[model samples]
Target: MSSTDIEPAESRRPARYHAKREAILAAAALAINEQSAKGLTLADVGRRVGLTTTSVTYYFKKKEDLAAACFSRTLDKLLEILDQALEEPTPQLRVRRYLSLHMARLARIQAGQEAPFAVLSDLRAMEDPLRGQLLAGWRTVFRRTRSLWGSPATRVHADLYGARAHLLLEKTFWLPVWLDRYDAHEFDRLEARMMQLLTHGVAAEGQSWAPELIPLVQIQDDETVNRDAFLRVATRLMNEVGYRGASVERISAELKVTKGSFYHHMDAKDDLITACYDRSFNIMTTAQRLSDTVAGNHWRRLSSVLASILNLQLANGEGLLRTTALTSVPAHEFALMLERSHRIAQSYAGMISDGVAEGSMRPVDPFIASQGLVALQNAAFDMRSWASTMPRERAVALYASSLAFGMFDDRVLEAL
Candidate 1:
């Protein structure tokens, strides 16, 4: 054979190697999204890509390394999108273009034209150097997302922009979970409706930001059990780590109790998580029901419920377990938890619908706005440090303002 022919055949080795490596990454990302970074098994990832565990290890030496690579790729993709968005001349156009591009990317993934990005909810599950690296990448993505709102002129503006950036990024992260519910052809309309809500918010013309604070009532069933401490500690751990990352042993250690004490309060780890969910849902439902009794318009009721829940999230006391843990939930229980979440979102949607009818809220899509509200409150736990810098009420107001008014609105600064 000629030397040129031998050289061409040898050159194909690198291209084939890269192609197989990309395939492994795509499979790993999908598996990580299905289970979680902690729950991911090299064997499982290998099976998804029709390779042996050792073969997968050739591409990624360890499972944590593989998971971190997946997260890094996602962060890289997000930064690219943000860079594209920065090309716009105005913040409004930048935000719109960002959403447009992001929604299109999601649509392409749904259409099987692109590989799925690993969900970053499980970043906390990773250990050591990987965790630090992923966090730094996240900070970069956050900073770029903040830049979508243009440069902040003042400290207060910076805070407002940070909150807005968080809201926007969380909503984008949240889209994949619910996007499957819509048809691919309808993605354009969905994007347009979401953009409208993000632009004008849910408030009607001449509406102000004042919302009554609703008192919370203790759940009756929870009062029957003296496991509040266990549930609270468990919820906190789960919120910090993920579901699988927050093991029974970890919860017991945090509570300074033995495994026996934990078992005494709860039957199993799943049961404990279920109790935490119940407690959170009860708190939310209590706020919603109490808001109904407040003497005001639908917008008032909605804002009060949001503020009350956000306050619960920001307070030093026991806070809501983030929905990010859902990724680690068992398949059988996932449906039930999702159903409960859907009901709460429906309650928010009902309020939005009433607000629109009563001329208190803008004529935006109730379903989209309600889901946006869910994304907002669920992500508030991440901003507790930011909240600590100001009064709890002001933190609640400022954070909730992202969705209450609009991502672009700075009225919350004046409202306080």
Candidate 2:
């Protein structure tokens, strides 16, 4: 009561201060999006808005403070998308539209042609206050989504469909920037196929059964039980700490097993890693099965399959591990893994080809389109590294929609 009374006597400066603070924040975001955040300066923002550095300083004490303000504004925009999507009539359609819109925004940003949207990857490295604000916005979005779709389903979708969408968009937008030769139309086609797979199941009617192919495993094990458990623990450790930094000792401790027990499970860490690779291959096979079982239109079936594949990865929380394997694994080992991953990509292409034949998808070069889609999704894994100051979920969604929509046909896209 006494504190409340004292506050009433204080000047209304806080309200006025916040209004000015928001303006400075908005200006900073604009500057960062126009140029690399790494080289951004408070002076740049002031100049853009025709203010002196001193005037900018009156609102933001430091460059970091201004950066924080920009981050907050970005988060607000992202949350708005989520809110609008959830408010749509059909939850599924809303989800799809949200993805499309989000991707379009990312494509625009990646072109360096527009202001960058807030990326979840970007927010990961922000200071606590900024991070908290971004997280709070995400929570509000999540709560609203939950009200539309039950929490369990929403959470599952967030991990599976949501994460898939995010990764897809991140890659499509960033790769062009990185390589400087990316085609936006090609990316659009790839996104369409991916979305089709996610919406439909993967198995084509009359598809023949083939023996489940087990990729070569370099790990030697005395017993399957020990091999399986050791691989699981090793995968977790490797994903968390990376291959070079991940130690056998830490994995053993987590398993509450002696070094001798760990050795009993595998010949060495390399062996365990190989086993983990084998497991990843096997998991993909299982996903193919689930995709085949779902009954729907070709696009619907493909979507189901895509969702399953993404769900498996999200369940593992091994996005970092996959990224590390691609970029940091020993060159020889990486080459082998890359080959296997390519095969999987080809299989995905085959599914799309089947869809076109079945009149579910528009005719296209499945192999080339699949490669682009794979590239986009793969690039998404690194989005966190680039956008370390933005909200993670928003970054993920933005990337996914971009990749998906970029692949859709002009006619289908117009309807969306």
Candidate 3:
């Protein structure tokens, strides 16, 4: 054939290739929704879209590359939303609209349809250039977000408003795990409950922060165990900020102790971080085992487990490391925390599966439900600042109910 005769076929090939790439990206996003970017595999994504793993690589060579692409997509979507939110005349209204719109989008994404934006499974998984680019983009949105409460001249005041807004926005990002099939009405109710908790704090009704002397390894013995108060405060700092952001110097200062005191207990900052993850996972697993013995079927048992986790986070200082995903830890310790965390998630899923079999709970995807439950459990730790505002029990009950029925009262859910 003449070269001209083959031109049309060759031209169409690139178009077809780009279309396939887009399909793979969409499929990857859905798969990541099920099991974040860290847990996602090229093979699984390929299977979901009816492509071979080898074929999938033709579009994105490495899983991290694909992950980076996913992260970029989510970041762009987030930036777009933040931009639209800025169009609102006031900051609070902007924040509310941003959240409500984002919640509705979550429902769409989980349902395997189009969404307003995308999400990243693991930020650390992406390369520096890609990760930095996306994060820088996010900062722009955040700066605008901070302005919602009016620009505070004081850094601390600005931070408080930013923290509250970000905390509320962060939880909705994980709603796919909680209510994959929710409608507009459900999103509105869920948003209302969230806003209520956000503005008023999680104090159940008339109660205020009633400090109890609950022990959490609350042990004060050896230098490694608890010789200094730095570790306890470190746990909170790490949970509130992150390991990188929670440096030894900062943590020591926060405890009103010297760096020497912090050094006296742990070998280094990384070691301290490792210890924190170890302690956090150990506490959660212990709670899980204890809840396993609670009276009733899987649903009740799950509730008891949720209660135990939420209360521990609220009651104990060490439980302050509130991240649901462990990828944030240094790569070396990632596997250990992830394995243990996965087991915990599975235990939750197993309970849902059991309840379904036992006829004690409504039908649901055990895997997604378990992941959703754990996400809620982890996020509850962030409510510590608000915990002091009300009765801890009331806050815990509200969290439990929110997990069971997203944006719903039990009565409202039943009527639906």
Candidate 4:
């Protein structure tokens, strides 16, 4: 080889470094998605990339560092997508552009052309400065997404637009869980259908937001109150942190009870989480069932179920366990939890299908709309703080109406 053709040591080193670092990040993201931040280990990530744990340390000094990097990469990608979407001339076009770009990216991942982004559900499980940093990045992503609907001129506009922003991002985050059901060739058609729902909404020409309250079947006095207490605390902790982060000791300490007391109510940590899921699903089923008993159009029944659930989520008592916990849930139990979730989604789908048939709703894809509803309700727990500022009824209407109405409809504001 000619001496002039030989690359400098500095150039060769940087190229090699960049390639290895990218590989490590890709592997770490996949591992975190599978097992969550708590389950991530340097050794596991290294094994995926054909490196020793010690060698991996050369790129990221700690597991938390690697996890943070993974989250940062995801935020970076989101900001990039938002930037592309913002270039469009109108809010509707911006939203359509955003979803189209994001769907394309997800399809690429599904087709093995790119690595997956780390799931942001476990962001709370990380320790500070990493946690703080990741959260700030996420807030930026959220603010940029909210901008897709245009700038808000008042507090009410801000809240309304904020709800729309959350709804959009949550559905985007939720795509990976169900997007694989479609063939890669169907992505364009799916995106168009999804955008229709996002822009126009599920309501018919003049469907109103007058949801009758669906009464839940109250728990009997004979039920063990202590077990309910455990579920409440565990559910909140798990929502704040994650499944593994909400350990037995943590739950016991929060309840001011002994570890023995915890075991007395539940068999194990897994059992507690499983029970939490059961409780959430039961509440959902009760609302769905009771809505069926109500006399109205399908939209009335659907809106009642949605409003009632949002009420439960915003109340001071125990709320539903978010689907984000699925990331840290054990594999064996994961499928079971997901099955229950699918059934709840199917209930929503059935209502939507009937509404469409009865001409009470727009001709939206029921499966897609149902999934969007799930994303809306599942993420409402995080909106409790936002919900607190206004009257509970107004909060419910504003937030629930994000999907109950469409992204562009703001008549819900006039009612408030």
Candidate 3 local lDDT, 1-416, one digit each (tens): 11122356546777778677778888887666545565668998899789999999987798867866766676666667777877888756676777777876766755657733345434543456766765675666557666666666554344345444444455666665446445655767767655543333322232222222223355455454344366567777766545555678898776667888788888777677667666777776776677656665656666666766677776655464655334345555766666676788888777778876876655565655566566667766666765655566755654455445433122212221
Position 186, candidate 2: lDDT: 54
User: What would the per-residue lDDT of candidate 2 be over residues 350-406, giving only the tens digit for each residue?
Assistant: 877887788665555576456555655444434344334334433333334433433
Quote each prediction's TM-score.
0.94, 0.45, 0.53, 0.94
Best by lDDT: 4
Q: Per-residue lDDT tens digits of candidate 4, residues 28-106?
A: 9999999889999999999999999999999889998889888988888888899999999999999989998989998
RMSD of each: 5.2, 11.5, 11.9, 4.9
- Candidate 2 ranges with C-alpha deviation above 4 Å: 1-27, 30-39, 47-52, 100-114, 142-198, 201-416
Per-residue error (Å), model 4, residue 198: 0.6
**Which prediction has more favorable lDDT, 3 or 4?**
4
lDDT of 3 at 246: 68
Give the Å error, residue 3, model 3.
35
Q: Rank the candidates by TM-score, best first.
A: 4, 1, 3, 2
Report, for all candidates in order, the number of backbone clashes: 0, 42, 5, 0
Checking candidate 4 for backbone clashes, the offending pairs are none
